[model samples]
Target: MSEQAPHPATGLSALLASTPFARAYTHTALAAVFAAFAVERIAGSVALATILGGLAVLGVGILVARRAEYSLVRLAPTTLLMFLAWTLTTVAWTGDRGRTLAGWVALAGIALIAVVVALVRDTLQIVRALGDVLRWLLSISLGIEILSGVLLDIPIPFLGIQGRIAELGPIQGIFGTRNMLGFATVIALITFLIEYRTLSVRTGVALFSVILGGVTAVLTDSPTVFVVAVAVALVTAALVVVRNAPPERRRVLQWVLGAIVVVAGVTGYALRSTLIGVIGAGTDLSLRTDLWSTLVPLVRFRPVYGWGWFGPWAPAEFPFNYVNAVLRESHASALNAYLDVLVQAGWVGLLLFLAFAGVALLRSWLDASQRRSVVYAWTPLILVALLVDSLFESFTLSGFGWFLLVLCAVRAGQSRSWRERMRSLDGPPGGVETLPAAGGVQGPDISRG
Candidate 1:
């Protein structure tokens, strides 16, 4: 018998399913929203920020709900939930309860969004989304800075433009800080490298991004960029080489690497003063030591729970007064991610965050090494950059760095290597034998680096 014509609703559903909206539009839009938080700074308008954040959160929820079957039983979810829960609890003790609540909501929203992206998009889509967003953000920022300097001739204070208009920098671009611009440059360079390596875009475009990022970094005089760039390069190179090595050589290389790490840590710790001098840093770290010295002792006052997450310093408050007196400038952060966490969340929040970061990094590293495609490497590389940057800057709770962390954590937790963990938990069924695998699964038909 001939088949009956399909129902109208069924046909519409099929057409919708075939559409590329989810593949092309959704991920890109989500990335743009995330970038806006950093690029626009949401103009510190709580209402605008809330609307944008809500949109992102809603997008993630919708996407995840559309999936046929998905698992939330993963490391990323556990760690993030713990972190978010702790952050929310802090509102109870926070001096400024309202701000603390806002901070918690923002954190939770991004974390959930990251999890959704990880669950829905594969590695290639993730990279593409990141590349597209950064390409636009960095490019627009560079263009604006040039315009403000050359044509406007008026300092764009909001964007942090100042000094002689002819000078290349220290231009803050749309990021509002030279260091922030530097950080964006580093991320841009990495994203462009991935795009170039994957042949996802024309070679010239990727090369241009690299060159632009490099030039911006130089002009900005962001020392952190140089340090982070070198570190990421070395680590990436090591990972690539080791991943490509034969099984036997891989084992030896890992041991050698471990030994090197141990030696380097000891050496770095022992000669930290000398190294700082070599890097042209004073013992006081350009007056940062003074801030640290003041804050460290004060942490003892609320050593267990912290003063509270994202605590706004009331003028007469103990730590705020002390910090402002020493720095001679109003400061929001301790200028160190670890210290910020310790000060805000106390030991409990710090420990939870550390555990969260550790799990994410470990999972991402494993996935990168196991995967055949180099695009996977971006996850760990970005994580490494975040870790390195956090040592000098308090970006852990900020927008981009935190967003990247959540993204990486979710990606890592859901990587194919993680499937092995599931298999371990529920071993092969009786009388069902598995055949040897041919090779690692291909990633999105993209070129292998």
Candidate 2:
């Protein structure tokens, strides 16, 4: 007997679930959203970039929903939701209701995109995609520098290329600020190195990526970038030690290393004056302090509810405007993520933010130490970078920073949440297993990682 033709809906469903289609869909979706991370720099308008990214996210989301699988119960980490709820509630009390609503959309929309991306792609896939994206962006930055500095001998003011490459140092790439370029390279370097260790990309490609990131970091001459680089290196070494230890000893080593980190932080704070000058970050530190001091009166006024959540301080807004006017500068953020949170959302909000980050970092760090593959290490290492850098920059609060923060939290939760512990109660004998994020995909064995 002859078979009847398949229905269009069924045919489309099968195609979407197929391996090749799934691969293509994930790659296209990730690439589009990642590009939007810096789309504002290219388009020169945050609103435009937000609108463009939302459209891209919606398009990919609709296409993937045909086959995508997710549970509302497990869509995102609970701590993250708590923090978001706090931010949402701020809308009820904030003076500028319209701006707060707009700000909330930017914060929530990017987070939603991060959740969707995590739902579709596996860890190795995410690292590889990010590695590829950074390589392209860094290369373009260098190419632009060469063109502006060597050929044109003029600044590309529109995109913030300062034509300083001919001078051989302190050049900002397409990110518009040298510090931002340096920060991006620091992350790129970490991603490239992890990608190399995982052997997820070709050896030559990985080596080239590392070099590109390294070269960009040098050209930017950003002190914070160097500090972040050193911090990442230290964490990498500690993780390596823990990872190579016997499985039984790994837990002990983790505690020992963590204690050392605490001691180092204490020591660093005690020697702040000497360390600042020695590290040549004095200028940067002082600038941040000046901006931070301006927040006292504003924060004192609200103290608990904050002046309200303006992710990036809108110059035209009431309290934010007053702050800049006093400082005699146009500062978008307090420059410290913690302080920024304190001034915007108050002590209560700050505590929630820390709790959200703390839970994710602790979970991801434990997972990395216990998991066998080097790929498992990426999440914790990236979290360390983000958290350490947050001390100096408010990048983690909005835009790409917020996106990454949520992405890591979601990834870590999927791999090592309490839910897995409950699941193990029913399905497995002694070990916990992470349920597949979506159909046709598998998750790592938790074994309590």
Candidate 3:
């Protein structure tokens, strides 16, 4: 018998799998780990979640060190450091020291993961990674929803279905809440739209994913998510149109935008009640107002640094217990991200976070406006969506959403850092050699598109 020779295709597969491109799988896996934690009910054992997170952290640590730039001063903005410092400092004042310490550990872990992602993967790679993860996650959730709602005749409460599993549902998919699933769907839809616009090879698949994600959001029956999705879609389209418009019109457009925003704000204030009813939030945000009414008084106890972060409530545990007792509910958060931050870290932390978000949004938006590539647009759009979502959901406190926020902030900060460096080098501008203008988020890989 002739000796069997190794197949060329098999060798090529192995070669490709060993390259940095193959890190897409690792990125997807990291996302899955974060999703498991985010969708805790469906994620099985805590130990499994920890192990997965650990492995991903280790893998990403190694890869980031090998493949990307690493500098604390360059990558970590002052706002970020301030936030971390405040969070750590507050641990000292937390009532349940152990619990707060544990929380800090988890928070640090997530922060490290964000650094790894932002530093190692460029903008295009980040988009591809996000696309891979969203496609996988949405597909799984859709499959499970079909199994429970269509065929199984069983409610999988962990997966967010309850009673009457036979019909198409108010299913939450794998996210544990209808709004969460809807939020995820909105994000996936936007990402896939961007991907479809930029990448020709998988345009059909991306479009189909966008459709599936949109349908899932609609099925979730979350008015907030549906409304925000439409708003974001419109905003994204408008931004792209403006970006491609003649450069001379850009400044005029900016002035027009500012005027439009002022008008919109006035109109919204006048029609506040009517708009609230239109969105089905009811007059009181389904009793969130009541919850806030109760919680706001307690924030006065330590107004400057209200309560410490780390635990579910303030340290000394006086007012939180009282609030929970009064509400007849074991509430973990204020149900609003900003309000929660104010409660936990007080005015100082809240201000730091706001500055961080404001700077990040401004920089990312500027980059998106200047860059022609659709891939460069995701950062700003995602930031806008999250900012809108944060009003209704406290997702910024944890999960992949928080991780992405940190990543974008770091990237924006890095871009600003590079630009500043160029500016410093070009001091006394006459006779100085011209330096390359700092590029946008679109990485070198985007040229292939």
Question: Across residues 281-320, which tens digit of lDDT does each residue of candidate 2 receive?
Answer: 8888988888877787778888888878879888998787
Which one wins by TM-score: 2 or 3?
A: 2
The C-alpha RMSD in Å for every predicted model, in order, reads: 5.4, 4.5, 6.8
Please provide, for model 1 over 1-449, each residue's C-alpha lDDT reduced to its tens digit, 9 standing for 90 to 100.
99999998666544333325445534554554445534455456565566557656555544444433343355254777898889799889977787778777777766665655554556666676777777777777777777777878777665566733267577676676777778888887888887777777777877887888888888777667777888898888889888888867877887887798789778978997887787665733666677788889879999999877763344455566678887697776777888888888899999998988888888887777766667778888989899888887877566667878887887776643444467456542111111112222332321111
Number of residue pairs clashing in candidate 2, backbone atoms closer than 3 angstroms, sequence gap of 3 or more or interchain: 0
Judging by lDDT, tell me the better candidate of 1 and 3. Answer: 1
TM-score of 3: 0.83
> Can you tell me which runs of candidate 2 are displaced by over 4 Å?
1-38, 41-47, 50-68, 422-449
Candidate 1: where is the Cα deviation over 4 Å?
Answer: 1-44, 163-165, 281-284, 311-318, 416-449
Q: Is candidate 1 or candidate 3 better by TM-score?
A: 1
Expressed as tens digits, the lDDT of each residue in 46-68 for candidate 3 is 75557547755664544443432
Judged by lDDT against the true structure, how good is candidate 1? 0.69
Question: CA lDDT of 374 in candidate 1?
Answer: 73
Poorest stretch of ten by lDDT in candidate 1: 428-437
Q: How would you order the candidates by TM-score, starting with the best? A: 2, 1, 3
TM-scores for the candidates: 0.84, 0.88, 0.83
Q: What's model 1's lDDT at 432? A: 14
